[model samples]
Target: MTCLTDGEPSATADTDTDTDTEGELLLRVLTAFLREDVSGWRTRSTPVRRGDGLWLRLPVATRERSRGAALLMPVLDDGYQSTYAARLPLLRREPGGAEFVDTAGVLAALRDLADPVDRGGFEAFAVECQQELDALRLHAGTRREVESLLSERYGVDPGSWTGLAGGLGYDTLAARADHPVYPTSRGRSGLGIAQLRSYAPEFHPTFALRQLALPREAVTVGGGTESWLSPRAAGAPALEGSHLVLPVHPLTADGPLRDALRTAGLEGRAYLVDCPGPDVVPTLSMRTVALASDPTRHLKLPLATATLGLRNRRTIKPGTLTDGAAGQRLVEAVVDREPRFRGVILHADETRFAHAGHELIAVLLRRYPAGLEDAVVVPMAALMCPAPGGDRLLIDHLADRFHDGDTLALLDATLALLFDWQTTLFAHGIALESHQQNISLVLDHPAGGGGSGGGAGRTRLRLLFKDNDGPRVNLARLRDVMGQQAPARTEFDDRRIFVDGDRPVLDVFTTITLHLCAGSYAFGLARHGHAPLERLLRLVRERLAEAVERLGTAPGEPGALLRAHVLDAPELPVKAMVTAGTLLSKERSGAADINKHYTTGPNYLRHDHPRQNYPRRNYTRPTGTS
Candidate 1:
């Protein structure tokens, strides 16, 4: 059997030029800053009238505020920067006026800012953020080096390389893996630069998994079937009694996990089997790995890393596995019951294994949607990733499929599917966290081949959801819809689903899926001059209107209530990451408390103010009727 430390280098050799590495570091920091700004974490003065656009002002004295403003200077377009600079009296008093505070100047200003005693946690967060930035920069350099090495050895351009002839390629996966906005949000805190390169999807490294045998008594297993537990034994002896096979990521195997196994008295009882087949490829989520031989089956493993301010460890509590199993059943029932949601694939957890009360060794086995083998499946984030050796976004690759390369048509198609799928799920009492990474898009020619090369009908787009852990159901409403069979409680009974209001459900779905996912994508398109942000939002509104009509809700049904909420709500609740970070620091909370942080923000979808004599319906009515 191959040991965890066998045949691997301890540290990566540094070959990157200092300038390039520093530039990459700056990009990572700026991306995080941009996320905070767009998410409404930073405060800005009211817009003042400018030449063509409105001008925003930032208080120069507030060093905390200035840090975000300064970072924004580098990534934002000239027009945006100018708008922020215009009419700022403080900047006007500085040398060379506002124009002098360029990207470099902003960086310099940030360096001069001092940390306050009250912001000790923020100071620590800043250090971690910088470390993550440095790690990502190193990862990027390693990718380039690997690309060059492969190119020279294989006599082909690796950057433009495609995988398996006509199938989906690694290029798309690689591009999407390195998140454009927050690449280091999921940095492995304890990992060195070389280990980060080894495990991170951006570097495109693959390695064999280490296997362990857990006696049936020591592990709590939940799934539809036991067959899912089959493992590639790789010469390891079979257990004398009932045992569940667990395949662990190599990094986890070397750390605390190995020590845990030894402490559990599994050293002699469990065989340390080598993975015999192909290596596992990490996906956009560093913890989830897909088998190289079979892409359809993915194994979600716990890792000792943190991303987006949440630790990567999956095993936290005991009831979570039970909740996951129950949630899967509930989602499967929804898909079967709703015809509009038939195409919405929930990559349900087929199996789960964990020691009761000990979540350190937890693992979930999930399968790709059935009958989608030929479809070009990619994470929604891939649409925003830059194409190979070009500034063009990956969505540009699908331009030929639409009429005159109309991006609006593509947006329309995608939004329509999203609206239908999400609305149906909401109506059935499930709120999906359909963020870009959790959701995937499957693009293909329409099922019977009717359209020409340049038309709206040429290609079809379908939405597939992963990470079933995100679906939350309102048990009260769920029982109203599903009758006696509906589950009254699950592991996530308190946290996952809203217990009282439809507005909270709508808020969660809209914040994560609409505002964050669609809004970010629209902003990216607008930033690149691909499409107008207003037009995209209008399309979203139109699609929501259609979804309401499609569901044919009466005046007071959940469907109608959600539709009204989407169309008429004055503001939506947006999860405040910065506030959450502060709360996390102050409370010293664990990762489970991450979702509890939210603050209200303006609803971009609602363009019209309330008018007298307009119909108002109660949102508190029971599920089905007016």
Candidate 2:
């Protein structure tokens, strides 16, 4: 097989905590720990409102009342009311008085106060956080180079490139930003600095895939790979038996796949091909790579790295390939039948590939439909991420370019389109994990009439969704909407995708779609002084109410329950991402699905508190600190 080559020149360390990158990892983690209260930290702590923001006086169990840690948080305006600013530090209070602590001090204090059961996990996470910080520092120079390239290439018009190029460009931009919740998002647990430089998207690495020859009889196969597979690209091997070629990630080829092949006693049946296969570049999700020859075609391969959490592997499970395709078909049926979704929502075709029933040996092909070459496709996450210059946000650039410099109008249009599709899907018994990363906005001017920051009124918007393996689908209701002959009747290998009750369905919608996707941008925009958090949330509530009303409010139905739980309830369900994704095990957390573990958080959508959003400023300071 092809040897792993260093894909790009390594970048040097460059960091500025004030504008970009992990200046606030420790504080962000602590804020989430308290807000989720997964370990009884919030109830024990006292909250003090300092100016517009809220500060948590954390109890130091080892110290007397005179000594404690106080963390300032950015007040949110939607469901899951608490959040932290990445630009802010932490405050340490003691008998000698309160002063801001450095990153190391925050980590030591957190370690000192952590519970015995959670201490190990917390320490592991802390290590990952530091690694993530270091990685970002190394990535800082390369990130600026990428921004410069895109800026110089695109000039004042972002839509100048084809849809696929624009989408890939925006994906690179999104990769540079920190995750709103996962504090150690950039940490690649199994990879060293060199490996990260070769494979990670932030580095913009392009490398060839390693090929393996597997006996046709020994592996389970799905969609066809004949059209793209070639002698020049994937080595035309003269095998003695009937064998099929499987494209493997260069990294996975060296680690898990070799071991798995040996364990399965297929040493003689499958052999590695000594050829550099189709050159590919990584997307935001490192495991899924885009073909360098034709980026429209993406290959999802198994990887040994862990991101988001130490326990969360990047390997592609055997069932995931088919299960994800099945979910895509079901969603396709919904989009086809729903008149409102016509020309408004599009899905990536993920129906082809082959698998050996092993996580490391599976491949799923992602094909993008035509017509994207003309529009600008950007993931929702990229809009709010820190911009390339480290001065203005990405949304600022988009707003100034496409929306006539009106950020509020751009956000309003986005929310209107998002709610229309998402709410309708919920009404039809499908709740997708349409977080910012999974969803993209397709924007184009009517009849190609607008450009150079002049297309404000005629801009048309659509939603493009991908990664459909984890949605909660009401099978019976889906079949009703799609009819008996529709593909909605397809069975999935992952039964977690099928939900029997409304609670589970609503949980996915509330936690992922509303809180993570919608609420995240709302908070980001508010924190950046784009608009009042309450005003944006009021728009959210109104849009949600309109969707519910449009869907019919039959009592106890999905729409009715969604309105009640999200708009009226004081506490809303939120995924305990840190606990489930990193700190705890299934047995200890008692989580049926580690990704779905839930906890109650304050619902800021409640109409009772109609106030102005907090002004943008440093939140780490004490009540009266100058």
User: In TM-score terms, which candidate is top?
Assistant: 2
For 408-483, candidate 1 gives per-residue lDDT tens digits of 6677778888877778778877787667777776666566756534444556567767665556567777778889
Error of 2 at 476 (Å): 4.9
Models, CA RMSD each: 9.3, 4.9
lDDT of 2: 0.69
Q: Estimate each model's TM-score.
A: 0.75, 0.87
Candidate 1 regions with alpha-carbon error over 4 angstroms: 1-118, 139-186, 227-234, 238-242, 262-271, 274-278, 310-318, 344-357, 401-404, 450-458, 491-498, 551-555, 581-583, 586-592, 608-626
Q: Which ten residues in a row have the lowest lDDT in candidate 1?
A: 617-626
Model 2 error, position 591 (Å): 1.8
Write one digit per residue (lDDT tens) for candidate 2, span 75-116.
Answer: 332233453222245555544555544545555556556667
**What does candidate 2 score on TM?**
0.87
- For candidate 1, list the clashing residue pairs, or say none: 185-307, 185-308, 186-307
